[model samples]
Structure formats: structure tokens, C-alpha cells
Target: MTKLKLSFLFLSVMSLAIFVACSAETETITKEVEVIKEVMVEAKSTLKTVQDRGTLKCGVNDNLTGFGVLTSGGTFEGFDIDYCKAVAAAILGDASKVEYVPLTASARFEALSSGEIDMLVRNTTWTASRDRDLGNDFTATTFYDGQGMMVYADSGYKTIEDMNGSTVCVLQGTTTELNLDDRFTSAGLDYTPLTFETNDPLQAAFEEKRCDGWTTDKSGLASKRAEFPASAGGPDSLVVLAETLSKEPLGPLTRDNDSNFYDVVQWVVFGLIQAEESGITSANVSSMAANPTDPGMARLLGVAFGDGKVADFSFGVDPTFIQNAISAVGNYGEIYERHLTPLGLTRSGSLNALWTNGGLIYAPPFR
Candidate 1:
């Protein structure tokens, strides 16, 4: 071809290249704009939503005693229930501002993710899958528990080994079920599991001797044993075996990606723990706030110490939020003693004891 024909073809090709590059750049710019818009539409923080609603919707277990239970008098009370109240008091300034939604083991995570509850304060174990796959943020482990087996005292069951080839009753959707299998199966013990979705039926079955053993968190076993009725051979008839199957660090959980609400829940737990550590009781919280002894105490109580400004974390609530929580439910120790001690789950030698007491219950610094 001649030079002129070649020049014309080159110009046409150059024009086509410029048009393609502009089109790609324009597409990229449009995509970037869409992303910016998507980023601009942020999810409303659960904190502001709860504040505006004037109540905290807390998911809890109504069946488990000493943790969360609906009473015969139509009121909810327990170790977990108190945390609900504490969060409510901290956020809404009224502990009674909580609406407790009773949830089963399987349904609790759904309730939280589906917005059926703002937070879950049931005896939920913090697991890797739950924190990551389930889209949840576990606050602190309020109670350190382990799975145990409760058997008829007369059954002469000394340990898990004794329960070989026995039928065990367990909650269907819990770590307890998994742990029970792990224990018995790993021990090379053969057993049949009688899985129930709720406690009442399981308790009834155990009462009728349908299952050779009942198993759950030791705290749960103690709670059930404490409330064992006369018609069912009473509390004395059952005994929790000494073998602890798994480490169940139970606590409250909020929806994932909700950092504001998660932080509030997490720190409320820490504050209560700090309150106990600082010797601030519900009875003396008012006095302590009025006169905090030191900088740490003053910061925790959100009070002025010797004319210093109150330490505020800007948690989207009043600085005295911790004080409100403490006033509502007392310290972590008080809450535990009020609920768990009566069940005979002593805190002195357990993981639930304060870290200072050589237990796992430790809180991060408030400041």
C-alpha cells in the first residue's frame, strides 16, 4: 500500500483506541460514584435507635433459671436478665426500659440478626463461628462455665465414664450438645442422646427417668437442681458430676458492624467489673460518685474528682452511664451473688471470680 493509505489507516486505529479508553474511564468513574453513594448510606447506629425508642430490646432465655427466667409473677429475672437491665439503665436511664424477648438456643442468633432484639443477653457461648459467621459481636464473657452431667445421686455415677452406654438428655442447639458428644465419644464411651429443644420437656423426661443423665452448662445444671421440685424427687436427688467438658465463656452479644452499640455493651460489662474491682457497690455507688476516691474511681463513675472534669468516653450516652448501670444492677459480683450463689455455684473458686482473685473475670481499663 502507498504511504497515504497507511497514514489514513493508522489515524483511524488511533481514533478507535482513544474512544475505547474514554469509554473505560467513564465506566470506572460511574462505578466509583455508585460506590461513594453506597458508602454514604450508612446503617443507623443501634444506640441512637434504642435511645429514640426509649427501650432496649434484649434477647434472653426464659427457661434457664439463675440466668434468665420468666417468673410465676410474670416478671423476668436472672444473671443475664440483670445485664439487660444494666444496659437499659445505662442507655435509657431506666432499667425497666428493657423489653425481654425470650429466645431458644437455636433462635437467639436469628433474633439478634433479624432485628427482633437489639441485644442478646442470654447464656450464649462465645465461639469463633458465632463471632465471624453468625455476624455477631460478643461483648465480654459474663460467666465462665463448663458443660457438666447431672445424674440421679442414687445412680452411683461418679463421672462421665460411669455414664457409658447411658442415655443423656441435652438441649438440641447448644455447645452443650456438641461438648457432650465430644466427651463421651472421645472417651470411647457409647451413649444415646435424648435431645430436647427446651428445658421443661428435658426436665420432665429426666424426672420420669427416661434419660440416664442430664447435661448442660454446670451453672445451668445447678440452676435446675436448685429449683428441682418435690414431685420430681427434688434437688437432693440429682448431682452434677465433677468433670467439666468444655470451656463455655457465656456473655451478651450485639449485631456485627454495630461498633457504637457493641462498644457500649462491651464497656458496660467492663464498667460493672471495674465497679466491683474498685469496691463500688450498688449501696455505695451514690456515695462513691459523690466522692470518688481517685482518678480511676472518678473516671469510672463519670464523676468529678477534686474539681477535675468528668472522664467521658463519648459513647453516645451520658458520661454517668456506668453509674446508672451500677445503680440499677449493682456490681458484677453483686449480680452474680444475687443470682448464681443461691444455686450453689460458688464464685470464690470458679472462673467467674475476679481476676484479682486469680479468676478469668478481668476487664480492660476504662480510660
Candidate 2:
């Protein structure tokens, strides 16, 4: 063969090989993009998954009374549990269509990020680090709480400074632990944190005097104190100090980038708050839906007012999603009164009260 012919043939062979390699690389890239898109679709479809699966997997706390607790009757009940039921009813139309997954503080975020639970309503606090670092997005702040110290009533400790060198029982992998440290460290006080992954052991340790005090959200402290076993000197034996260490806004959360499910969860909370503001109650929700008095009420109830069209916010569920939530768990005030009021967590003159009543429990406009 001639030199020119040899060179041309070599160029052609190399060009063909490069083209094939490029095509294969392009195909691999295309497949990767498709897989990413598919994962995103799946991530955003938590609402549909819950609906089609016939149940919502809700991560909760099965120990904190007045928030989320497992009762002796083999059922879950509390403020946070009611929020779970409210979300389930909003999405599934049935309050009972919920599969509660009890998770500890350390494991709650993993349960959510791993899809072990569709939503987490386990008294999880909404903090900057949790919102940005964790692969999750907190909905609304269902309860405005603060970190508090609960010491034995006779411990003679009136403040955080009073307990210098104290050992405090706190849950691990929570902002509570960090905030406790921040409080004590900033006060130039020395204390040891007896961190436990679960509250059962922490409570046992506290009861056994392994720790001088127990620290968590004040609402949690109230819940724990309210349910203090009679054999351990009962509720009156403990008192939550007046010092609030941090602003802990407790709420439900969903996996990050799941905006559809996030919207449903967020607005379900707003709807319940709006229901309370609109004077809608579980007992009167049906009648209000049937005969909404004004456009605001009609829009809130997802009903027509004076022949106008129903105002649906399109939360990937029925227009009456809020109505269903309210019907299932009553309004926000009702839920609070039912679960928290008995714990002596008064609503009046507190942050949990409605905005109309000079509190921070306000929701955005539905329209």
C-alpha cells in the first residue's frame, strides 16, 4: 500500500473509534440525567405515594405526653399526634389512615431522609442548622416553645446559674443539647450533659438522680412533669425553671426538595390555624362547609359563597383538604386545648395563642 493511502486509512479508523467513544459517553450521560430526573420525580411525589399506599408513614414520638405518646390503649395520642392525624386526614380523607413510626431524636431525621417515614411530626424543633443542614424542610411551627430546665422542686435551684456543676439529662443529636451547652457555657458555668438517645433512659436516669436536672423544650418538660409517675413523687415534685435558653419552634418536617408534600403539610397547619381564626370547629365544620357565612369562611372551608366558585389552593389534594383536617382534629385552638391545656400549658398570654389574641400563632392568607 502507498504511504498516503496508509495515512488516510489510519485517520478514518481513529475517527470512527472516537465517534463511537463519544456516542457511548453521551449515552451514559443521558442515562445519568434520566435517573436523576426519575429520582426527583419520586422525591416530589410523597403526597401521591401516601395516597396510593392507603396510609401516611408519620414519624413521631411515642413517649412525650401532651405531644406524641403511646397510650395504654395501644393507641397514639397528643398534640403532635393530632397534627399527624390532621395531615393524614388532609391527604387521605381519613384520620385513622396513619402508620406511626416512633423515632428517637437522633434517628428522626434519618427516618425522614431515608423515606422510612413520609413526614416527621415528632416534636422536632425547627432550627437554622436543622433546616439547612438536614436533608429536610420544616413546615410551619406548630408550637412555639423554648428550652427550659426542670429540676426537683426542692432542689433550691431557681435559675440556670443556680445549678453550677449540675449534670443535666438531655437527648442526644438535638438542638436541645447544643442549646443547653450554649446556655451554660455562655453563663461561665460548668455543667455536664448526660446525653441519652431516648427519653426513657433519660427519664430513668433523672428519676434515679443520676442527673441533677432534666433539660428540654419547656413544652416537653411540661409534658414530662404532667405525667410524672406517682411513685416518684408525682407532677408536683418537679418544676420547670422560668429561664428559656433558646427559641425552639417545634413543627413537622418532610424530606428536602419535596415541595408538593411540603406544601400540603405546611398548608394543612395553616388551614387549621385559619379554621380557628374563622370560628370553624370540628363540631361545626360540616355545617360551615354547607353554609359558609362569608367569602373568607367559604374560601377557608373550600366551599362556595353566594354562588362563587370554590377557592382551591391546589395542594395536590381535594379542595376540602383543610376542612377534612379540621374535621379530623378540630381547629388549632381545639387541638391545643384538648392536649396541652390539661398539662397547664395555658394558651392565653402565651406564644401559642392565635394572632388575634396577641400571640404568634398566625398563618398566611389562603388565597
Candidate 3:
């Protein structure tokens, strides 16, 4: 063949080869794009998975007063109940969109891990074992509590040391029981633990003198004191021993791996604490939103726009989600006063106070 004919034939073959290579590359890219789309779809499916189900299923205690009490009207109340409301308000923008599943102490964690509830807020203690080994995440502590023993005023017991060789009533499947055992054992005091599943049955046994003492969180003992039978001379008839056995940072918890949902639950608690810190209560949240000059407050209330909209936090919540939460359920302090203080529990000198006040209740900057 001539040189010109040979060059033209070579160019034609090269061009055809380049076209096939480009087509193969395009097919490979298309398959990758399809895979990415599937992953994205699966991810988005998890967003608001609880809300899409139309109710926030919360695991709570059925008997512990001032923490997770079920009233005679079949309604749940107390500190844990308020945090559940905060979660619902933050996610659904309506606090009442919650279904409380009253769980026993032992059932709380399993209920959460099994997806029987979206969150557990049953005055659960956040321990390393429960957080790491139980496959759950403790968001934030709403209440700083410590275990104590309660006895009838007439019993004349002033300290745990006085309870040596006495029978103590305790709730089963709780850190309270373990703490009671450890406190007594570490002090070389011999005491019998009468464990019961529910507080009602336990209280009944206590009233019947089945045990010489009742051991639980100080706040819980206070709550029971306020509600004790008037025939038993009411709250003044009982006394909480002036000793705290263990640090019980009771808070809300969710399943692990869902960071977005976790943030929503976490910040609901933080928002309440932040609101209390900023002097914003349920009664004043609206007015503060109307004239929010503080950057932190504005960002929290979704009034100030940042590099991204406030909702860019990707917590599966609206920008003003916290504002809604505060509006629905009061701030942390208000919740404490409304539910706890009435039961004779005090906030002073406890871990539940604000960090500025030398307590552990601190929140991250809203920004």
C-alpha cells in the first residue's frame, strides 16, 4: 500500500478503539452512580424514621415517682417524661406526639435495643458498661442524682451506718440495688436487700415493715415521701438519709449508629439547659425569640442565619426545633421545679445545677 493510504487506515483504527474505550468508561461510571444512589436512598430512609411512624415511642418507668411515674389517670409524669416531651417537640414540633411505653427497670435497655422504643428516658443511669456494651447511647443527663436510703422518721435512723443488720427494700434491675449493696458492703455493714419489681409493691412491703429501710435515688425517695399515705402522716413522716451512695446521672438514651437522631435527642436536653442558663423559660421563650440579640440564643431559636441555615446542623429537626421544645415543655429548671421540687427534692448543692453554679449541667454553644 502507499504511505498515505497506510496512515489513513491507522488513524481510522485508532479512532474506533478510542470510541470503544470511552463507551466502556461511561458504563463503569453509570454503575457506580447507581450504587451511590442506592446508598443515598437507604440513608434518607432512616431520616425521621421515628416521626414517620407518627409517634415517638419512649421507654419509661411505670412506678418511680419524680422520675418516671404513671399516674392513676394512666398518664406518665416526672423528669424523664419531660425529656421525652422535649425529644418529641424537637423532632415532630409537637410535644404531645409521643407514646409512653412504661417499662420495668430491667426492660428499659432491651426495649431500646430491640427497637421496641425509639428512646429510653426511665431515669436510666449512664454507666460505661451500659453505654459501650449494651449497644446504646446516652445522650445527655437531665438530672444529677445520687442514691440514698429512706426510712420512717420514727425509725430514728440518721445515717446508712445506722442500718447495719437491717433489711432494706430496693427496686430490682437497677443501679440503685447494686449501689445499695456496694455501699453497705464497702462499709462492712450487713444488711438484707428485699428486691421488688415495681415501686407500688415495694412501698406496700415497706409500709408493712417488710424491710427496715427503702433504698433508691434521693430524688425518688423524696417523690415517694410527698405521695405517701396521709394516714402515715404524709411526707414529713419519712426522711432521706443524708448520704449519697452513687452518682446517678439520669438522662435520655437512643440506639447507636444514628447520629442525626442522636443529635436531635441530645440537643433537646441541651436546649432546655441552655434555655435555663439564658434565663429563658417556657413562659418567656416567645418574647426572647422576638428580640433575640445574643447570637447563641438566636442560633438556638433559629432566628439568626449562619453560614448555613440553622437547620444545617442535620439533626433531623427544623432550625427552630429547640424553640418549639422549650415552648412545649419548659426549661430544665422549670421542669425540675414543676415535677421535682414539689416532691421535696432540691436543686442546690447537687450535680443538676448549672456549670456556672459549680454543677455538671452544661450545654454546648448553640452555634
lDDT of candidates 1 onward, in order: 0.89, 0.89, 0.82
lDDT of 3 by residue, 307-340 (tens): 4344346565688888999998889899989888
Candidate 2, residues 1-367, lDDT tens digits: the string is 2347546655655565566567857665556556655555554589889988999999999998899899999999999999889999999899999999998889999889888999999888887778888878999999999999999999999998899999999999888899998889998999999999898899999999999999999999988898899998899999999989999899999987788889999999999999999999999999999999889888888889987898878777999999999999999999999999998999999999899999999989988
Candidate 3 residue-wise lDDT at 26: 60
lDDT of 1: 0.89
What clash count does candidate 2 reach?
A: 0
Q: What is the C-alpha RMSD of each candidate to the true structure, in Å?
A: 10.2, 9.5, 11.3
Candidate 1 per-residue lDDT, tens place, 195-291, comes to 9988899989999999999999989999889889989888998888888889999999998867889999999999999999999999999999898
Ranking by lDDT: 1, 2, 3
Q: All candidates' TM-scores?
A: 0.88, 0.88, 0.85
How should the candidates be ordered by TM-score, best one leading?
1, 2, 3
RMSD (Cα, Å) of model 2: 9.5
